[model samples]
Target: MKYFLPATLSAYLARTYLVAFLQLLGVLLSIVYLFDTVEILRRAAKFENVSLLLVLEMGLLKLPEVGQIILPFAILFSALYTFWFLARRHELVILRAAGLSVWQFLAPIIGVAMMIGVFHMTVINPISAMLISRYQAMEANYLEEKESTVAVGEQGLWLRQRTAEGGVILHASKVQMPEWKLSGVTVFYFSKEGDFLRRLDAGTAVIENASWVFNNAIVNSKGRAPERIARESLPTNLTVNEIEESFSTPEQTPFWVLPSYIRTMEATGFDSRKLRIHFQSLLAQPLLFAAMVILAATVSLRMARFQATALMIGSGVVIGFLVFFASSFLKALGASDQIPVLVAAWFPPVIALFLGMSVILTTEDG
Candidate 1:
């Protein structure tokens, strides 16, 4: 019992160190890939076909979002890899023979996993959220400037309308397709050259199957006399449907608002599968990390004399890959409503836990 901490700590340190290193490498690689892709798109956006500093900034900001998804699998694979090597070198066997149970051997790894979960939830997720928000802003600023129509965010809503005469920033606060009315509206009209022209704020704007009707609107026209008009009757060439199509999707709601965002999205009768799956998956992360440790122990721990360690290591690597892809596929299935979100989110860790336990039992009895 007294020796348990030292042994576990040693193993945890080795395992987590390898995991962190691999994950960092993966993150850097992803950053490079994202940078190149973003650069290509940004160049296309430029008249001279050149990328700007803001484009690079946007890429850098997007890296954390990519890392949030990739780091967990990297940690899992790294553990498997490190453990396989330790087993191949016969360290696991020596440890087991030295009166350490497999559970004891895994204790440190599990601890590391828990730490990772906490770090991800408390630190990495928030950081990724901030980066994603920043990236979205940068992307919108870059895009709406060039395109006549721009899609912002994932919901295929909140579009931008550009014209040779002027540009408009259209905000669709809420859309009621059944009533053909858009509630809570704000529009920013810019000069033909993109200078600020006027801003229109409306409450309960409606599209009456034809023209747009602005209710209780305040129009602030800039330049010249700098006039302000407030009236119940406002006419515009912008239609409700057209304005709704012009703003970026409301799906761009900040990550900090995910709880309320999820609720609001669900209430709106939208398919909440993706968000549900993501939230459930977030809740399952600690278990997933814990399962990874158990899996590493089961695959890498020596149970039989004269066993082919190389073969076992290879098997562990294969199994790790299978688990990773299987989890991802299940996540996709859940998002598409082909499976229950809870099942998709929780099954991977549950399945891994069972398999690892089975392996541990098999080894111990033999």
Candidate 2:
């Protein structure tokens, strides 16, 4: 009975925070889906074949990703509401009079927020990735009229490039980093007008001088004898960066698979800065949630004491946007190598955490 009361209060606070968070999330996602559906309809208007069902499906598919994008705001607004609700009913005053510190009660809310972050990172993200990939495919096929151009797998690297005739397919069994060097390279030449022109089997190939330089290549063509060539060159408009950029974006990659994908991209001599930052950001999400909760608590607690509800709510909203913009700026800097990935990914949360702590300490203790 001694500890039961405190435990019950903690559970109540956690439950309240979670319920508020979910309510806000539901509202925000609904708004996002509606706006997105309208945007999809507008974009699809040009394509007469686009159907209403497809548009609705696309909107539904995007909700998970959109939910994540608005997570921080949801946390902030809900935490604010939860704290304010408790204060409005004088529950916090009663708890304080019973000698419970702010941190003791805030602990449960922060814990719930952290659990939400972990769930989002581990469970929600992979589902969002899958759904968003489908959304992108639908968008591309129906709206953009684009085709997937590149892929990497255990078998090797494969590339398809459009030619005026039809297409050219290239495959490499092994790739060397820092330069576009390949072993066991095969190039297939085909035209849309005809089935195929020829195939080239190269023992080694390297991209240089805006072309593929093959060493010890065997050329095979239809109705012709295979010809051996010591050196052969094929013209290519592709650059290494362009090829790298053509692959799926980080948001399209599943969370659990992102680490290995990052390593693979790094091993292939592709720039993995964006992936690193993204992965780091995921790692920092729990702290970000905690920081948001603290900031929300700081504002809500102040509002409760001073009864400046409007000013405090507005301040919380401003803080949320400021944190978002600062994080985005830092991410851009990290992508451009101006700042360290760890710094870019971590600074905003750390700053917010400290800011919230300072305000709460001064307000509550002083």
Candidate 3:
């Protein structure tokens, strides 16, 4: 006969797991923030005008991005510690002796893990995205001492390139990738002294070897009459890969807007595989968290007296590192189109969950 825990017991288990998770998250975030602050200070050291307050502010702004990276590990360690603590107190043993299966007691922890994953995806991700974007902008403005070469927003795609005589700023309402073409294009030419020299409007622009081939171009020089040309070639240093890389970074866009942004990018004929992979990865967070919970249970359920705690903890750490490495590898493959995006983002968690569950089922009468 199998025993089941009451709702009250399940709730208590969930509360315990939640508390442990929060404590671990706080400690991990603090450590990450400290390291980030030190790194920011080191970078700011190169700029005499930069202040410690500003460095600290940058660290604070970057904390959420760091926290997001560390969250899965936090969940893994929290579950491990919670299980170890319960086992040390003989709580798990008592519950098991009462005829309850291991799976029965694991229910609440898994539920909590899923909930945490959902909360992270829905709430924390957007906030982190905004902060990270701000952090990058500030770092560029202050630390890098240079403006970004490319930008994408609601208005259009904007690019800046330096030429021997002057700099050119280009705007394209639409971009067609692979062939590297732009439509509804406009280009502004400025002299080295920051004086505007001329402007050109073109119906279409195609990237050639070292210049843009504008078609149906109308040139408007500062003091000259407008001249119309069938085609004009202008020098540029920007490359197709560079432009795509700039706008396709997943971190720059919020989770809530990724779908729409992906659609827009696709509409502009840009290959959005990377963004698609990232979106799928976000959707798989809950499953990954659940997998971590199962993996933790498998490693930490042994009584402290029956095995060396250090060995178990070390084993868990190694397993966690392996999982992360495999996930990263698969993501790379997915981004490069070696595998389907959905497979890359989801296979690791699914495999981890099933493998952990299988191990538990075989080792324990769950």
Candidate 4:
């Protein structure tokens, strides 16, 4: 049985990986195509250079970002397929007859799920962050060099601010959700609201405990300032949530930053439901995947006793989808305050786990 564990686990992992990679690749490519087409259409309408190669490049660059978003679903569906295949082949029956318990069968899938969770959090997510950042930069340069000065891109809002001290140019490339922090920001101050007050730029900016901490600020307050303080610090009463609210998109912040971001938002008297739900989603993903594997195994493992592959697979898929839908519904309900966020987050996984357990137990007892 101990020797059997490694072989069974390896087989399950291989099957899950193959299914997940294929499905995710297809889903991401489709999304990239649509995104690229929309951008090309927008540029061509303006009589700009929207070349075929440019569209291809944009699609290629955006796929990794989409992959990160779809990873959880990929894992779930892949596990389902693997377990279904195993049951359909009667391999599960053989294992059980050889005294392999349901828990033993599940150990490998659990291990794989943990590995995938770590991979998503560290490796895949960073790739998504980098690709998204590059995409914004390219889009920004394109907008700045080609069209109107006040135009916006896929990144976020860009504007010019005028004050007694001088004229300031603001570029906020991305906004963190729920509590709003700005990413890839640049602020320029001018003398007499025309020439320049100074240049202050940061890779990222957030309001923490009421003060704006500019990360990697580059300042140049050089010249024409009888009223202006030269080499002076810029003052802002903006909370992190406020700055985050100003950005139009939520994809700018890395997943690792959302926890602290939510804390910053709540501290500043902001609603963090959306961010909270997204955070909860991270934990729910692996559990959901585990349940899916169990459900698939239960259905497929009984093929020798029940010659209904099509019916079984169809029912299993429907059950999988229902589990997903139930989760989204519960999340929406929780977000509206009808249910607790924690309950909503765990509802799908818990329900699925019990359902899988009950089914396996009934079959074994019968």
Candidate 5:
């Protein structure tokens, strides 16, 4: 690899690629932040307590998550522009005269993309997860006017649900994993107008299909003395799977945290399909980034005077989006358990890489 491109040349190319990537990222982030701020402002209008500063803060907190979603497109366009600029300045003509092959130059770009993938997994994702978690909390508090339906903390496991008569808040001091049982359970019932209706303290509670069965429960209502019952049932629309999703959503979980969290979900009788797919997808990001570089380079390595830039770029953007949408479709299939996780995660990147390489080989030879 050192022989393929001299150390200085490789450094130069990588530097150029990185500068373009960061510049494009900044541009896109600015545009998204502006739109997000506007949206947050509109949502905060009904709340007298929500200030303009708060709206801006909410948008800034949300921007990283949106950036995570925008990253692949940014890589594609920036790499494409970098290569086109190189060709436009006749820099390639100079390199060609020096006997440098396309691969000699492209290897550096691929390496940069791989590093970016690692950076995203380690640095960007954790930051995004933390900020987005706060963003969700703020959104729920002011805009949505509801807390998360499920949460797990040092205090215990908590859940909430709406009933025809009112709402119920549940707290479990201890959750028996794999057995799907809770001990030291309490349920607070509230009327439709948010008045306290009653409370139930149970020795234990377990889910049986669509309801929670509480054992040795004591009922406390406004007018009546606490009544002990051997068994009690509460009908609910919540399943264990939905509760798991609400507790540890992929967006709110960092990449470093996902594996153990997935295991926890699985241990709690949840299949972990959604989290598994997200994990696999993140694992595949390096290859996907490298593939996008190849695809972008394939469309961009010619001058318009020498080749049709408009047609080639248009075709490239269309193909890039097709690849993106294809990956999304496969992810949806994986979520639905229609396809194997590995296939859904890795296939798009692998095939796109091969296809881009084939086209580059054919064109380079001709």
Candidate 6:
């Protein structure tokens, strides 16, 4: 429980770990950005309206999300590299001979990993979400798709659809997703010149085969008297897939705001399973990062004696990939409601931590 270590040793170890982490992050981000830019360019080439600059902008906007996905890998590699370098320089051996335990030497690196996780969830995620939202909107516009403009907010669900006349704005006080039904709906009709023509209020609206079926509706024209109808059908290009796809992804929501957003989504009768999983996963990030440090130490601690640097590094990466795969698979199960969110989110990191600790104990203590 004692947090004290030799000040100079702690500072040096922490600085080395920090430098390695930052350098690894930079290298990973650069590789990701370059690959993403190339992919985006390939996709954009098919669209006549999308320019090179726009494609680059979209790629940049999407980098944060990609970076987040790769962060654990970055941490794992950085920790491995840092510990290997120290071992190669005989620093770790000297410290061990001086009566320093493995845990004592690992303390600084673990602390740094925890802080990086916190910073990533708090600051980096929100920025990434905002940029991704913008990129999606721009991409939708360039593709001339109505589905991209749909959004759910405090007031209700809002949608924009294009027609031969101009556009239609649809608002619903409440939604039943998966079925794509709406209650307390209002539809605004507009002319081709962007002039408002009339509005229709419906007690309920249901999406049906490329159009919406409104029951118990009242139509009010700009210059005509209001007319009531028992039911009406309006042409729509909105589909079930489009409506569902319009909602901001759980990852797009910031960690700080996820709780409230999850509540709102649940209250509106929308499925919040994905959001719940994402929020829990964010909460588990620090532990996951710490596990990365433990795994790194396990792999790299013997590098000086074995001198199998390449093999050790390769093994570390394989382990990292396995961990990533397991986490993703668990997340998929969580999102589909096959397992409890907490179990899906926390189990991966917890298992990884225990596994890493077991390896370290067997190697270092035996």
Q: Pick the candidate with the highest lDDT.
A: 6
State candidate 2's TM-score: 0.87
What C-alpha RMSD separates each model from the true structure? 6.3, 3.3, 2.6, 8.6, 4.6, 1.9
Candidate 4 stretches greater than 4 Å from native: 1-47, 87-90, 136-194, 197-250, 267-269, 303-307, 334-338
Q: After superposition, how far is residue 297 of candidate 5 from its true place, in Å?
A: 1.4
Model 2: which residue pairs collide? none
Q: Candidate 1's residue-wise lDDT over 217-266, tens digit each?
A: 77777755444455443334555455444432323333355566566655
lDDT of 3: 0.86
lDDT of all the models against the reference?
0.64, 0.86, 0.86, 0.62, 0.85, 0.87
TM-score for every candidate vs. truth? 0.68, 0.87, 0.90, 0.63, 0.83, 0.95
TM accuracy, model 5: 0.83
What is the lDDT for 211 in model 3?
81
| lDDT (Cα, tens digit) per residue for candidate 5, span 94-174 | 877787777888999999998999899888898899999999888878887763388765557789888888899998877
Worst 10 residues of 3 by lDDT: 145-154
Ranked by lDDT, top first: 6, 3, 2, 5, 1, 4
Q: Candidate 4 residues 1-366, lDDT tens each?
A: 353466745676555656665675587568766876676557645536656666566666666666655555566556656666666677667767877776776677766765677666656665676677666555545533422133234445465544446555666676565445667777777677277556777776665554445676666567633232222334454444434344323355567777776665554444667668767866676677677666765675564357676776676668767876898799888878788888888888878878887887888642
Question: What lDDT does candidate 6 reach at residue 89?
Answer: 88
lDDT string for model 3 (166-196, tens) is: 7889999988766677999999999989899
Q: Give me the candidate number with maximum TM-score.
A: 6
After superposing all C-alphas onto the true structure, candidate 4 shows an RMSD in angstroms of: 8.6
What candidate 1 gets wrong by more than 4 Å, as runs, is 1-4, 7-59, 139-160, 169-173, 177-256, 266-270, 302-317
Worst 10 residues of 1 by lDDT: 150-159
Across 50-107, the per-residue lDDT of candidate 6 in tens digits comes to 8998888988988887888999999999999998899888888798787778888899
lDDT at 347 for candidate 4? Answer: 81
Clash counts for all predictions = 9, 0, 0, 14, 0, 0
